[model samples]
Target: MHGGGAVLELAELAFRELALFAAFGFLLGALDNLAIDLLWLRRMIRRLAGRRDAAPWAIADLPAPDRPGRHAVFIPAWDEAAVIRAMLENTVWRFAGQDYRLFVGCYPNDPATRAEIEAVARRAANVRMVVCPDPGPTTKADCLNTLWRALEREEADSGTRFKSVILHDAEDVVHPEEIALFDRLIERHDLVQIPVVPLPHPRSRWVAGHYCDEFAEAHGKDLVIRDSLHAGVPSAGVGCALARDALGALAAERGGLPFDADSLTEDYELGLSLAERGRSGTFVRCRGGDSQGLIAVQAHFPATLAEAVRQKTRWVAGIALYGWERLGWHGGVADFWMRVRDRSTILAALVLLAAYLAMLIGFVLLIAALATDYTLPPMTPVLALLLGINFGLLLWRLAVRAMFTGFVYGRREAMRAVPRAIVSNIIAMIAARRAMTHYVFARRDRPPAWDKTRHIFPETAVPRP
Candidate 1:
């Protein structure tokens, strides 16, 4: 009886400490969300008053380009034989008649992916495949660097230069007008990013469905809000366009390599680097085509929990770990705060684990108290107030998330977003731990390998714009 009581007392003590940490972390996150919420509200109010912005428009008109400027689409493929053929064909059909060339980067060893790109290139006039000298998947950035060199060589040989460089993955569903949109906007903005809508798998709605929720809110509101604050717009690794000259400047700065070859999230780093260098970058989310669908780069995300965790682990390692070591905190106030927010994922996962443990311990303690008839102390007023505010903020965040998710994916997925939020939290926690284990203290004997997820192209025929 005495030992049981001691165990219960220790559990109670642990529960208190864990709850305090979780509550404090939640409050801090809530405060951060509140700031962004207030900023978004302010933006909407001004827009309601008929305010006009030069760069980031809420609804911009995009018409077909009249003999559009030269544009190059860069796709870095590694073991993407499954979907590369379909994606390439779709890109050719969608962007037909547009003055753009598709430059695909392939590895010498990955003949499967190279064959797919070659099969498409042989049919399309504008499609070109650049083979990397390296054997296998060195890094996505290394492939991109090879493609950049190829583009420069082609320009030198042909005496023609591309005006903008658009980045896309092999699994992307390219919008017909996105390249033209980039061509038009690249004159003013160094980088322009369109919405990235992750296609939810029919089978894994609860797992892949959460991505739709996240991208909906992020691309729909958070990025727009960032532009309103004149903050740095980090690239989503797809559906982003960079000006040719801006990229050239970066290449020159980095000894002819525009991308950081060692970085996991090279596209993301490029956007932030351009922003830090005072280059203009904007995000646009608007309707395109007669169907009135959003001009987003839709792609299939991971459907299984293991795949999701692996992909997110790469992201966690890239952004919160390598990103910090590479790009130290130096930017405007808004940009600085945004960087902190991005890096907070590590701490956020820690808090989530603490909160879950606290809940478990609390349950155990509650049952012990019930069995023993032992008295418990009253809740502290400070802790009570903190939790109360966090609850309100939680409800607000869920409502807002649902609103954004429904905006893009409709009511059914929006309702599912509530449960998927739990899944997302678990994935984040797992990814954080995995990132620390696999990437942070990784062995440095050999080069970092490209760890890309298997991609899927939509089997259904894509509708023409």
Candidate 2:
């Protein structure tokens, strides 16, 4: 009985310590989020004070050029046979008359993907496949570099210089008006990123739907604030356009290879590098003909838990671990702060895991104490205060998530965001663990490799409205 009492006491102490740690971590995260929220709030206040029309710009306001400058669309494929055909077909169908060419990059080993791209290229006059010299499974950046070289050759042969370059994945559902939007925006901004909305999965709500929730919040609020603050807008890899001049400058700086082949998140680094060079980028949220929000790129994310884990692990590795090693902590205060927020995923995941464990253990202990007729000590005032603050912060976080999700998706999906956050937290914990392990092993001798996730393009096309 004495030993049992002692064990209970130790467990209680452990619970208290865990709670303290989690509360502290949560406070730090809340502070960072609050900073962003405050900045966004300030912008809203200023806009309101100026009484400026907050209406979204209509797509018709930006007319397509009569003589559109040539734009090159880069699609990098590896084992993407399942969706590449659909993607290319959609691209051709959407931008039939636009002065743009779809340049697809494929590997020699991925014959199925190559075949599909070839079939599409043969069908469409504007579509061309650029086969990489090297075999399969190289980084996406390498494939992009190969496509860049092919673009140069095409320019040399055809005497048509592409004014802008757009990057996209094989599974993306290309927006019909994106080319026109890019055509107009690239003239002003060096890099332009449109909102990327993940289409809701019909079956896998928990796993795939989480992506919708995240992106809705990220592109809707986070990126908007980042752009408003004059901090760089990181490229979302798809639905992003770079001016030809910017690409040329980057290539000249990097031995004629604009994309960093060694980096896992080259798209992200590219935007930052351009910003460092005093180039401008913007995140445009425009309206379509129906006065509804449109001009956003849409795609399906991973539908399974395993696939989500695989994709997020690569993101954590690239953005959090490898990014810190490569980019370091540089730039102005806002830039440095955003970088810290970006890299906080690893620590955030650990804290979440700890919080969940602490809750479970505490619940079990409470039940055990009641059964044994033993009472645990009362919570300290300071600990209670911390818990109250954390509870409020959690509620605020959930409300913000729901607001963003509802705004992009619908009210039904917004309600789901509250519970779906648990799914996201679990995936983050698992991905962080895998990412750290991979990064440690990669530091020895191996370089960062492309961790490809299988993509599924939806059968029924639901165009972005």
| Per-residue alpha-carbon lDDT of candidate 2 for residues 1-465, written as tens digits (9 for 90 to 100) | 313477787888788888888989999998788777777677667766764543235677665654469899999999999999988888788887889988999998889998998897887899989999988788899999999999999999998889899999999988888888888878888999999999999999999999999999888778888887678778989999999989999999999999998898999888888888889988877766654457888899999999999999989988999888888877788788789888999999989987988898799788887787777678878889989998999899999899989998899999999999999999999999999998887764554667889899888862342
Question: What lDDT score goes with residue 416 in model 2?
Answer: 98
lDDT of each: 0.86, 0.87
lDDT at residue 2 of model 2 (Cα atoms): 18
Residue 274's lDDT within candidate 2 is 88
lDDT of 2 at 433: 99
Per-model TM-score on C-alpha atoms: 0.95, 0.94
Q: Estimate the TM-score for candidate 1.
A: 0.95
The residue pairs found clashing in candidate 2 are none
Candidate 1 C-alpha lDDT tens digits along 345-442:
99999999999999998787777667877655567788788789889999998998898899888899889998889999999999999998876579
